[model samples]
Target: MDKKVAIVFWSKTGNTKLMANALKESIELQNYQADMFKAYNFDINKAMEYPIIALGCPAMGAETLEESEFLPMYNSIKSVLKDKKVFLFGSYSWGDGKWMRDWAYDAKNNGIILFREPIIAKDKPTDDILLKIKKVGIDLLSD
Candidate 1:
């Protein structure tokens, strides 16, 4: 089967959504399939069938994951992601990106092959930030 990537995200203020869109564009522009969906709009069962994934969300207060419907849904699939290659993305309003750090560790413990650090930015990503996200996208599709 041809290679493809799935993008699942939850964005309240559109910062994270912008990242998701850029990532999707980057992946599809590589001639690969990129499935984009809001976290609530996503179907996790179908996502596990994909070989790779890109998960995005804005860091909530005190560097915590957004406690949306997606969190519990993601927890159920956490173990199953052991054999999958995944990328994490999000936006931060304040404080250090501890959420991303701890999240990275947790996913690593579950055996997911993390590609680089989780992409993080303060509030909306500016031009430079999007450039970095684009680089992450290139990396995701490269190998």
Candidate 2:
């Protein structure tokens, strides 16, 4: 059976969206079914349809998740995330990606299975970072 993956994210300045698109492209290249969604358009219930999920959101005020939409959506789905395979990625302007770390911790606390440590880029991603992001998508498709 073909595997399915979901790439969902919120991007204010378009940085995180760029990463999401890169991941979606890489996943498709691997022959998996991959869907990309902006946070507002994504329905939390749709996450259960995918074997793997990649979530992205830039660090917001004080190194926290974006409060307006992403955070609420995440909170709604987190409980059901137990034992689910998940990947986290996002861009950060400062503070050493503390937000991603915190988010990862919450995911773990809710029993989600993290494929790897969260991938982070500062502001816009560099070519090297984009390569790494693509690698992450490939890795998630691997057994």
Candidate 3:
């Protein structure tokens, strides 16, 4: 069997958390092993044990990243992200999703391979948005 995959994120009002859950289901739908984690409980070192990492977060103030748990968790794992296969998704209310774009840029610089363009949604995601998150999970397993 291949290495397991983990979808980790921070969600305020459950927006991004639901996205993470959907991703877990999607990967499982592909007959692959997957897991979900909140930002605070996430362990970068332990996560390093897995080959795939799916990260999600909301667009916070001024379209910057949600600083509370998102920044710290990501910063802890950022350096080792190089060469890891990653998929990114998030919910946004405004600002053209600069947060997701900035995250993708950072991952790229860290040498992680992106499976696709970032999955983004404005405000709370509908079924259509959840479907995209599902596809992201399948894409990761396919890789």
| Model 2 Cα lDDT, one tens digit per residue, 18-126 | 8998999898898888898877776658877777889999999999999989998888778666756799999988888999999999988888889998889999998
Instruction: Estimate TM-scores for all models.
Output: 0.92, 0.95, 0.91
**Against the correct fold, how does model 2 do in TM-score?**
0.95
Q: Clashing residue pairs in candidate 2, if any?
A: none
Candidate No. with top lDDT = 2
Q: For all the candidates, what are their Cα RMSDs to the real structure?
A: 1.4, 1.1, 1.5
In candidate 1, what residue range of length 10 has the lowest lDDT sum? Answer: 68-77
Using TM-score, give the best candidate's number: 2
Instruction: Give Cα-based local distance difference scores for all models.
Output: 0.82, 0.88, 0.82
1-143 in candidate 1: lDDT tens per residue? Answer: 67888888888899999998888888778888888877776665867778888889888877878886657656767876777778899998888889889888888887887877888879899888788888877887765
**Number of clashing residue pairs, candidate 2:** 0
Local lDDT at 115 for model 2: 91
Query: What is the C-alpha lDDT profile of model 3 across 1-143, one tens digit per residue?
Result: 58589788888868888888888988887778887888888877867787888888889998877898888988888776776777788888778888888888888887777878888878778999999888778777763
Task: By TM-score, rank the candidates, best first.
Answer: 2, 1, 3
Candidate 3 — which residues are off by over 4 angstroms?
Answer: none
